[model samples]
Target: MTILHVSAVKSWGGGENHIETLCYELKQSNPEIKNIVLCVENTLFHERLNETEIEFQTAPLAYNLDLRFSFKIIALCKNKKVDLIHIHDPSAIALTIIADKFASLPPFIFSKKTSFPIKNKKLTLYKYNYYKIKKYLCVSEETRRVTVESIKVKDKVITVYQGTSITNKSSETDFLLRKKFDIDESKKIVGLIGNHIRAKNLETFIETVNIIVNIKKRTDIIFVQIGSFTDRTEDLIAKVHELKLENFIHFIGYIPKASNFIPQFDALLMTSQSEGIPEVIFESFYHKKPVISTNVGGIPEILQDGINGLLTKKQDSAMLSEKIIHLFNNKELAEKFVTISYEKLITNFTASVMAQKTLKEYKNILNGN
Candidate 1:
């Protein structure tokens, strides 16, 4: 089966990581399957494939309606004899619609990795319904439900949790992650990983740190955020400065395979206002680390309040601080959370398992099932 994976996202996040991992696993599982990845030029995703032998190509996609890029997509579909087109972003879906007019492209498959509702518009409906979308592989049950509510394609949607590699990831050296940041090992470290964006709700995380440090007088705890700067970056950084949290909070920019460094953290923190099934959550599980995240989107589906992890309401910095402190002080509870999450990760959310499930769906779709 020949599949063309299309993604136009410029930034690298869980969605990008999902695409890369899915493609790599697909190639490894079935070397006969001609899997090709089409990513935007100069993106973090593009740079990530440089050392790998994955069959990848690049296109300079500027907008959702770039006809030139659309033409290239059509050419790849025809020349590569692509039996399926698995897109990783909304922009790539738009390209599929534009290509539908001028070429007899293959059936499209889209992975909905976020709970954000599809916009209700004539054009939006046309883009989704007009194309031959075989299946909507949602990363979570919540995503599937939201997709059904937002679009008229209920039968086409299926919940396929984006499984992660549970195998331990080895870093290059004895990573002195805290030493480089000048953070002492004796202090408790909480880490957040994601792009500095509105959805990530990094401001709330910073505010929670501010409260933990200044209000609670817990100078022994240091909060570190690792991610790329988005449009809302200046405001987030400015908030840190205004709160006098420069020393307490460290904004460590984007680092690939961040979980390798996360073993140093006391607990993983995610203040996202939105998510599907966060890959980092699974990473923390593999590392035997607990997570404190906002109860948004599909987080609750994975993070049981007192079971695998702790969850608080969105934008609730005070409550978030409380959860953070709870994890820090309660050793038994923290260890229990880690143990339970790791068990689930091994049993269900593994890369090999995801590949088998996804490949089965692909085969079924190809067989007219």
Candidate 2:
């Protein structure tokens, strides 16, 4: 089976990482299935794919409706004889709709990696419910549920949880978090990983840190955020300074293989107002670090509050702060959470398991089941 993966995103994130993990797993487990990527030229995804053995091609995405990108899609579909086109993001879905106008492209398998409800707009609705799209692979059940409300055929939407590749799991990173930041050995590190975006709710992260450090007067715990910086970063930093949290909160902008630093963190903190189960949670599971996240999206599907991990209400700084402190203070509870998380990762949430389920769906789609 020959598959062409499409990603029009300029920056790297969980969705991009999902494509990488899926392709790598397919190559190892099912070598007969050929997977190739078509990403925006000169983008971070394009740059990262160049480092891997994965076969890929790029087209200039100068604008949303760039004909150049659609033309490249036409050429690849015909020249490569792609059996299926797996669209990774919403932008790529719109691009594919444009490409289909000029050529009879292969059947599509669109992956809905976020839980954002489909907007009630004519063009947006048409693009999402496009005729050629045979399957909608949702990252989580919550995502699938939201997607079904927008899709014409409810049966087309299926939950296929995105997972992390665990083959290279390690704690040996040269970039030591404690040493580089000059953090005291006695201090516990709480790690947050996500780009500066509205969905991530980084402002809430800052507020939670303020409550823990200033209001609560906890000096032993420090926060280290790692992700791509954006225009919102300056404002976040300003808020940190305004709250006098410069000493407690540290923003260590984008680091490649940031998950490698998971071992250094005492716990993983996610303040996302929305999500489709961020990959960092799975990474933390593999690293055996306790997690505390907002009760949004499919996070609750995996992170049962106080069982494997803790979950707080969205944007609730006081509750989030309390959970973080509670997790850190109770050593036995922390140990229990990590143990359950690690077991769950190996049993249900590994890349190998995710690939096997996805491959089954691909076969069913081709067989017209």
Give the top-scoring candidate (TM-score).
Answer: 2
Across 207-284, the per-residue lDDT of candidate 1 in tens digits comes to: 899889889988888888889887788888898999899988888777777667778888899999999998989888
Give the clashing pairs for model 2.
Answer: none
Model 1 — which ten-residue stretch has the worst lDDT? 166-175
Model 1: residue 71 alpha-carbon error in angstroms: 1.3
Q: Model 2, residue 156: what's the lDDT?
A: 94
lDDT of 2: 0.92
Q: Estimate each model's TM-score.
A: 0.97, 0.98
Q: For model 1, what is the alpha-carbon lDDT of residue 199?
A: 88
Question: What RMSD, rounded to one decimal, does every model reach?
Answer: 1.4, 0.9
lDDT of the candidates, in the order given: 0.84, 0.92
Q: Which candidate is the best by lDDT?
A: 2
